[model samples]
Target: MATLEELRKQLDTIDDQIVHLYEERMRVCEAVGEYKVQSGKKVYDQTREKAKLADVASKVSGEFNKKGVQELYEQLMSMSRKLQYRQLVQAGALGRLPFIEVDSLEKETARVVFQGTEGAYGQAAMKHYFGENCNCFHVHTFRDAMEAIEDGAADYAVLPIENSSAGSVVEMYDLLEEFENYIVGETIIPITHTLSGLPGAKLTDLKKIYSKGIALMQASHFLDEHADWQKISVVNTAVAAKKVLEENDPTQAAVCSAYAAQVYGLEVLADHINNEKDNYTRFIIVTNQKIFLKKATKISICFELPHESGSLYRILSHFIYNDLNMSRIESRPMEGKSWEYRFFVDFEGNLANPAVKNAIRGLREEARNLKILGNY
Candidate 1:
């Protein structure tokens, strides 16, 4: 029944009191952080947080209010944990990460490996990252490339991770989880697919078209035009070109890069056959060593979340509270767990930064099986 102005003043007074109490609460949390630092205790205590939420909910009225109070406390507790983490970082109590920091990759003496034949996009990415004249070899499959680095047969391996038009190269993500190899760097190359065949072969003479599965999908517009042409998926585009050249059949053509066609001595019958003109593919450079470049600005990590509401959001809040910018996130099914998934996230931060360490520490405690894939 009070006037609108009187009601607004009452709300303002409550807000001021709430701010004062919030600062007082933070001061108490700081004291707790100091005690934990001296006692070697962890910042995140899941059991304590569960109990605190229950206690707060009991003090509130109605189902909606109970839920609201629980959510509010969850955020307040998360902020408290973050503050403690920052204190630990400042006190040098946060342990060193497993990754070693290096001034530069040993490009001069490092042996590189790539998937498929000589002219695959992986080879182009390798040349661009490691240098054109770097020592390198080819592997038959992506698994083979991963193994080459895992077994120390090669110091590094170049593999395609994603495509602009076709989306993620899913097998690569699975392979990353399956292997111990870590990414050290990345390179993106513009993709320009061409239809090529024997020196004298014409587009009209093509009976079958061959390329990698993703390549065929990317050039769907051009392939759809030649509906009569049978499409075959190979291990790599370069391999397709090699197949066409070795068959000596004018009826068979390949969808590949101009460089690949030239490598296999095939003549281009059609150029730029991809559906998107500005297509590109991102490639990752992986190695067996758990080391990161001193100047690396990006970090890739993967983790499995508990099957609870807001789990992903809670995990991601670490990045927000630490002021880290996440650039990409992708999820893949956990190998044996149906419906549940594992998440891969790419964020902007170097492992050496204090804020980066603080976020990672909080994530390690809250997320299950959190793995730092790389920092590059």
Candidate 2:
């Protein structure tokens, strides 16, 4: 066996050769990119890529070496594809995106709808985004809010899409995919849950606690401290407070926002019982039209992956190639399709941006049912 220092020296020499080869490969890829641009041909060629992968893998000896070489080349090719995509963008070869760009969201005279009753977090988010005096109404369910927008009963709808400590509002994601709503803007509100009850009710008098499922989970530590308390899921925390007051039961309390409790004429029994002190819930302003603001800096999209190996990696390569920063990614089971999932992704860029255009073009060509949810 060679000494450790001798092996290190040899490895360094091999790395130098690899770097030089990599530069040469990139130059060739750039030439190919130029050719494709001139020929008006598509950037992604799946048939050619598959053949290349197979040919390269066949040259390796052992199974381990074959797999390793294939993986390495997969990454290298993906990087090359990204470089080509960038070249196309710089050369003004990327085409227009599907979404219509708007100067601004209609807020002053627009009618808005929100899920849950008055004093709900959705209401607060709507007010925060659309000004305190904006025209808005409440709906009993998130679906109802979506329907309101779909029916043109409202210009926009405010709905929660995610929470900081408790993770995503998954139902909202499903609804977005199910409906034709487009997210135009997003707002984040700090969440501080409190246990509230009737004025004379004590902690000992509480038999059941009602709140949204996520809110209950966020306050799990505090609720767990009192194991005897029954937990009930409601539509929203504000709705739970409304129920507590309507029921007029001292035995029932609500785990809700302080504003909700106060608005519903309840007294706070405990304050800030959430697991994380800096918990926040992100709300999206959605509309029925497929429009985005011209100044929008973030985009959300969803797509279903083909049921084949390396499909996801191939799709993500578009983002890598365009140098787009993906902020969040989530997956939900595709409706009516067992064991198959649809993915939702949020990335930084506008629809009008060349890199964004390049990424979306490649993704639309490759992924199934690629939908641009919004640019905000």
Q: Which candidate number has the best lDDT? A: 1
Task: Give one digit per residue, the lDDT tens place, for model 1 in 64-141.
Answer: 999999999998998899999889888988788889999999999999999989888888888889888999999999
Q: Which residue pairs in candidate 1 have backbone atoms (N, alpha carbon, C) closer than 3 angstroms, thus clashing?
A: none
lDDT of 2 at 292: 92
Lowest lDDT 10-mer window, candidate 2?
A: 90-99
For every model shown, what is its TM-score relative to the native structure?
0.98, 0.87
Candidate 2 residue lDDT tens string, 160-253:
9988887888999989998999999999999999999999999998899999998999999999999999999998899899999999999999
Model 2, runs deviating above 4 Å: 1-28
Residue 315, candidate 2: alpha-carbon lDDT: 93
What is the lDDT, from 0 to 100, of the residue 50 in candidate 1?
A: 97
